[model samples]
Target chain A: MTGIELRGVEKAYGGNKPVIENLDVQIEEGSFTILLGPSGCGKSTILRMIAGLEKETAGEIFINGIDMRGVSPGAREIAMVFQNYALYPTMTVKENIEFGLKNIKVPKPEREARVGEVIEMVGLTEYMNRKPQHLSGGQRQRVALARAIVKKPKVFLMDEPLSNLDAKLRAQIRTDLIELHRNLGATFVYVTHDQVEAMSMGTDIVLLESGRIRQQGAPESIYSAPKNLFSAQFIGSPPMNIIKAENLEHGGASLPPGTVSLGFRPEKVIVSGEGRAPERGQISFRGELVAREILGDHAIYKFKTAFGCIHTKTMSGSTVEYGKWSVRVDAKYLYYFDEKGDVIK
Target chain B: MRSQSGVFWRTFGKACRLAVNLLIFAVFFVPFYWMFLTAVKNLGQTLRLPPAFWVSAPHWENFGKVFDAIPFFSMLKNNLVMTFGIMICQFFTVIPAAYAFARFKFAGGRFLFGLTLATMMIPAQLVFLPLFLMFSKMGLVNSYASLILPWATSSFAIFMLRQTFKQVPQELIEAAKLDNASEWKIIFKLMLPIAKPTIVTLGLITFILNWNDYFWPFVLTTNNAVRTLPVGITSLNIVDGGVKYHILMAGNVLLVAPALAVFLFAHKQIIKAFTYMGGK
Candidate 1:
């Protein structure tokens, strides 16, 4: 397993403005690193550049400490699983997994042996004779996995491989991919727009916005302590609730100077009846309950307050009444941001 | 009462549809029927006043007379060589050209594609004189090279296959590249197979068109040895300054049989190729 690095990478089509410019990124060896961003944010572009499927406008890329200039994607020792699964439609499942190995001139016996091992690893042996069109989405996705796994490349670059799978299957494959990464101990550079996939699967998350790295660190750190307003709002389900500093200050919360926005996790906020006084060193707001979304284990509450709508996630069957409610959060959990949306801390 | 009327109306509609279809079929079949009839008739029956619709005695020997009048096997060989040569050469030219036009975005790509399409719109009839002159200067006229080389590359195939190849997802090509397949392998193994229907349809279209192509080959070749079936068959129309209608019709029947046979066997594929043309 080897790490990957991109230096001063820029990408643009024709004379149009650059989609990505001067972007630098590094993936540690044996780490499941995620390139996470919104659509058109150039995460997939970066992955393609790493895989040498795309040529950057002006950049140097390295895989396993080897410069990738003039190195074809095949010679670079990387395998990619695409969003559409990209299984050779004309090939049987066995052939689809074995084609890559055969292309690199691996011996027939070795190719077949490796292909069989990967097929069994992905649990697709029974359907090995079936073409991709004949398989279900999950099964096709597994074939794509088997195709990449059989190559046994230094880095496995996946561009939203799990996005096409249904939710349950997505979850199942996520677990499988994590376990596979552990067992293979190969570097994985996965690109996805879904924050849930990023947070759940990536050991290292490189958060991106409009082609620039917003923050890069462990997924837990990126969630618990975001570097900017984008990171704060992007990582969590329902996102972190953001309120203007003036409103929070008016609601009797002390704030740092030049802090224009305040943020706190929705799950961190506590919802209680309106009559409950604010606890010491805690900030509270009184508002009418406007909506409730019961999500099995917990429910999300939306309240219309003086500043704006605020949301809180509370365990189901709580004692909060419908008409008026109080939203509270400990002062220590609140995040302060400046006018630039970067965290003040 | 409503159900009874509905059944009557449905039956009437079916009858009307059947009548229209049969009329259309008869209109198209009349030419082939006339060819077959003239092909089996003697010169006396063919030249009869008010044209006898049926012959009392069929003269099947007229078909044999066609081969004796012209170098039938040689002309057949020339046609086969020229048509299949153009087809096989097109695989060398059109597939790679169409693939490049479909996928690559080099400088002047749009203008180049525009030029390709512009050439397609110019009918081959318009280019024959200039092309014949070029071939004559190159000493290729009056030879098999003149016939096969002139129509070796087709603008129509490039356009059709370009449209189909453009619809092949870029992801598939990228996936192949990452899998260690070279560019040529991707084109031959992945793209050619993916574009099989279009290629087959194009091949059959080329076969039929060139099999019956008269003017281009006539403009180039003078001798019977290199002349294709159509030009050679024209000799049957006038042997020693006398018109032989029966023999010429028999020669035409020979020229048309192979194309018709191919169409009958692969009509489904042809229909499918056209139904999903451009992109699917």
Candidate 2:
């Protein structure tokens, strides 16, 4: 009953400027689905629509086999955690968690018990008496989550709930959220602009751009085989280098005699000995090292090539001389895009 | 000791602040003081110059005379009834209208709100005669209805309150809605608590205006039973043959006292309302 199925969902503001068109997604009952996109890409809008915060202009939303057209958000049994952590500033943590329960007319003792359980689940027992204004951003976010989960809602909608936190806090909360989902075994629809969050946290990631879904699949499959140019470009950090390719026949791409456009990850490029130039089963690019950023475990190198600039990374303790270098690329790791930004697969 | 220049400037600045405050105080108090002195004096000294900075003795009997000359108690009662009635009506009506305007997107809401604010520019004097004749035709004349009915709706109250309600986060409304709360719950449980200061400020302004109102109430009610305090004081002038300065001063003091006291007690809240209004 908790699984969500959206069929040809269309939304527009006032019958014009359609924001989302023909959005079809099916979420498994207990799966964590992340809606990943850039800001203003209608990711949050979809989450709001699912939560019933927004009315669907033209679509059918089904929870289990039940049509959701006449269902209110409260009756839909879905809860949402907002980006700003919309914890009632005037209400204490305990009261905030109990607000929906009280509204639903749950018996007082049961409401109290639910509040206590969710407060413990969120690790906010210490802050139960504190108003939201007294809590830090991370604590406020936890309170919002507690408010949502205390209802034992069928579907959990999170709209960038962790975006307001610091990097370290976001990472910590991400793991906590995964653990929480596992424990609850409830359907979770999370919206975020961070690809890393989508990759690590989503059981299934729905990537969006300009109000349309670019791709949707299991996180591993999406990371490995992004469907198109937008998916390939958006799914990874230090995103896939989209090099334009010349004429290529059947296989992947046929490199022109001199140098066909080649794409390779930084880790895929090997620092070969000067005598042993890059060989077969590998594409070669020779250029001066334009830039070097040594992150803790991996180093990203910017190589100035004839095509333009190619970004490749190397393992720690391996240093490339700036201003001049030759790189041996693994042809297996290469990605090719046509002049139209479509994958040449 | 501190340097003479630093001390001098510090003292000078302190004196400057005090002087500015005193000047402001005088600007407000001077007319009342003149009225008080004139009320106490006999006809000969009533208008005597540099305005009587001080009176020779307290005229305690003037208050009794002011009441004896006019049906002062009835007028006071009428004023209270009208002022309190208008404030109550405003409280009930303005909040809901304000809440709707602040939160909803119905067509013509902005236009209606605009139309409401436009009422502020309308001169009250222009409507005074028409309202009086209308009340006369309706047989509401010489009754408290004339004084209380015209004040039931205030555009300023709605405008002030909508601006207050607008500051409440949309997230809170959504949160309430998601809980299956009715629109009424969102207004009473959520909006009202947040807008308490504004309501009080509006109430105070309405009360003060009604309490001191002279023109409309005077034109509407001929008898003392329906007359407001300001108009009642004016009626006292005729009984005293325009020579009982002490009695008139006593009546003026009585009329002004309640408003002054209310202002003093709620000064902080008034300032806060003004600040909120200015911010909007």
Candidate 3:
């Protein structure tokens, strides 16, 4: 199994401020680990360092338990799929996949067999002779996948490989990639800024902010028990809402010392209708409806309260009208946070 | 009435464009037409009134006489060697220099590239005297080295090829590197194949410029044994009486025919190169 570990990685371009510093991360073998962060947060930088494409200023990277200090990208036993697919524009689909085999002196018969098997895996056998420019975007993406898969490296690193595709194609390829990881059983280090993608595709998610890891765990654990305000807001689709703790009722029970904010997921909120009040021992806020978003299966309603603005998502077909409304969530679902945004369990 | 007027103006515009195109074609074609006509004309026909567009008695022997007037075959061989020597050498030097300029960002890179562009501004005539003196000092004045070595690498070619190389995406090279390809493989198999149009354009330009050159070889070599055909044709001018224009034109036809054939075959690539690289 090919696991990867980065200890104390630091990166700076020229003499400027470091883009990433003192970053440590571990990717378990055969796990789909997502380096999830916003743009300029150094997620891609870490992936590049693991691939040996970019040199880390200070760190030791171990791939498959081997020190990768001076190993070239080719010798690292890893294959990379770039964001743009990066297929050689001058080569046909077959040539692009077979070029690496030819470079390593793989026997001609084996090379042909490997290329054929991989091309069929990506369903690009019919377009084997077509150049990249002639193929459509989805086909080109498949060819890029075929090129990477034919290498059969111990580790696979993908840097937002599905970002360039349309939404429908991206979803389809995302499913394909999950199946691919399962079949190959190879470690995959994927970098993406989209939290939805991170939540859905990753087996182990490493949430990053700037250069530091905010949290690292399985997707369900991170989503159910966010460690901090950033993780709470980063994981969910409209994210968790946090309001100032002052003047908010907490069932008359005392909060932990230094607790300054209250948090709850939008889906956890129960929008009160039929003029009914909140249930006992639940935290409630009174506000007027400000906005509405109608999704196919559900709708998100925004409200403005005396404390602050918050949102509640509910199943569709609910006739929640405009004007004064009260939404509440059980006290157990509420997350309390300190002044510095760290969660208080 | 307005639609009829619009049709009239459109036809008028097409007529005007056709007239201008034909006029431009004549401007370029008349020189070749006159050269071929005079090459096949006798001495008296060359000086006839209105400059006879058609040769009455074609003097096809004039082309054969060109051999007797000067060492045409030897000079022809010299021309071929010099042109091809510069081309093969230029190809090697330009690809590496341009690749470095386009791909790397070492210290002083900007200044070095600026210096390359600066060399293109200086006139060749300014250096011809010093070049000839230097070659003579080295005892290489009459050798093919003096003719070919001076133009082994062209700054214009480097600058042009650098622009073309820059347009190739950086990801292509990085992908090749990750594929375990050697640097030489990345260049010969990848960069060279991608930049084919610009390279072919450079080749055609190099051939035409070297084939038509007269003054540089004239100042260096004293005899037809070492000089190119352009310089060799000078000996044909002082025959019979004074300046035999017909025979001089016949030698020029032989010197120019090969370059014309090369251009006719590869003009498509030339146009493709200029169309893309010119806008940049």
Worst 10 residues of 3 chain A by lDDT: A246-255
Off by over 4 Å in 3: A247-257, A274-276, A319-324, B55-57, B104-111, B238-240, B276-280
Clashing pairs in 2: A248-A254, A266-A312, A266-A313, B39-B245, B39-B246
Q: Model 1, range A114-178, lDDT digits (tens) per residue?
A: 88888998898899999888999999999998889898887899999988878999999999999
Q: If ranked by TM-score, best first, what sequence of candidates would result?
A: 3, 1, 2
Task: Residues B4-67, candidate 2: write the lDDT tens digits.
Answer: 9899999999999999999999999888887777666665566566556787975566677787
Which stretches of model 2 miss by more than 4 angstroms?
Answer: A247-262, A271-276, A318-321, B1-18, B29-52, B55-57, B239-243, B277-280
TM-score of 1: 0.92
Evaluate all candidate structures by whole-model CA lDDT and list the values in order. 0.89, 0.81, 0.89
Better of 2 and 3 by DockQ: 3
**Top candidate (DockQ):** 1
Quick one: how many clashes does candidate 3 have?
0
Candidate 1 local Cα displacement, residue B32, angstroms: 1.5
Native-referenced DockQ of model 2:
0.53
**What are the chain B TM-scores of all models?**
0.94, 0.90, 0.95
Work out the TM-score per prediction: 0.92, 0.90, 0.94
Residues A1-345, candidate 2, lDDT per residue (tens digit)? 349998999899985888999988888889999999999899888888887889889889998678999788778888888888776765788877887888889999888888898898788899999988899988888888888888888889898888889999999999999999999999999999999999888999989998888888999888777667788778776777656454223235456333434455556677654446557687665666788898879888887766567777777876777766676776778766555555567
